[model samples]
Target: MAEGGKGSRSGSDSDDQSAVETNLTATVNKVDGLEVQLVLQVRGLKPKGGLRSFLSKFSNHDNPTDLCANAEFTKWDVTSSSLSIEICVHTEKERKKKKGKHDVNTVNTETFTYKISNFPSEIRPEKTTLEIKQPPGETSYSFIVLTLQRVDKSVSWENFRTPRNS
Candidate 1:
């Protein structure tokens, strides 16, 4: 009975995840003329420094990590069009002035780009998850999640209707 209970619980958890994914797709793929937005949410990060690096999995809803990227375009414009996201994060050097010793962690700015070429023009909505990798040395963080979704909008008059006492 305990085994069966665990199986059911896992099944329900998968169901919940599937439902959330479905809702995200529905939200992005509606009304052919509205707009398609690329939202970058950082799930985790680790500043590279050998074994001393700390992995940060951000879960703060109140203060989210700024990915510094927001790209939006029309449904028709974005359809079948190539998209490239290039971001550069620079970390300055920190000086430790204790006991006349200076420890500097100077990380340079890296402008890395990830591109999606020729998005499918089919009527079916598509979703793709990409991993933005960080170079081996002198970079801010490594291993980030990037979700790509295209929305189609077919505007309706009901959206613009005002309340009336007919």
Candidate 2:
């Protein structure tokens, strides 16, 4: 249940789903303990195949045609059993002339959450992808892509934290 928070996922460990070992990467802009940038490959945006791919089309109307643009990881929390990934997407930004300075700002954030667990990652990389799996009772191979998943070491932080002022 990775894309746009649709579908239920099986906690059962099985190999029926297609496993694509993809190495994930992100753009780390601000590291005051929050806001990690995710560089989404446009190709990955398209579902691997099947019903999920068909459903993906309808779910992305409000979002940009290209899902990778201006993407960031707003939340990265890990526990003993699972890792929580919350990514937010923004539309193209506009620069406004404020006094003598020009400031770039964009709004209208769309978020998608994914849970990373159950299926074990054979190896750990700096950055990694969340597997998109069909929930229990759905066809076994509808939509499944095993992507590399792990936060890059460069974006170091002791624990998940929000803006200090917040």
Candidate whose lDDT is highest: 2
Error of 2 at 94 (Å): 10
Where does candidate 1 stray beyond 4 Å? 1-33, 42-80, 103-105, 122-166
Q: After superposition, how far is residue 60 of candidate 1 from its true place, in Å?
A: 31
- Superposing all C-alpha atoms, what RMSD in Å does each candidate have to the true structure? 18.7, 19.2
Against the hidden true structure, what lDDT does model 2 obtain? 0.35
TM-score of 1: 0.31
Q: Write the per-residue lDDT of candidate 2 for residues 38-155, one digit (tens) a residue.
A: 2222112322356644666466332222223344555565443344555544433345567987554434334444554522212243333343333455432222232333334443
**Model number with the top TM-score:** 1
Which sections of candidate 2 miss by over 4 Å? 1-3, 6-68, 77-81, 92-106, 120-146, 149-166
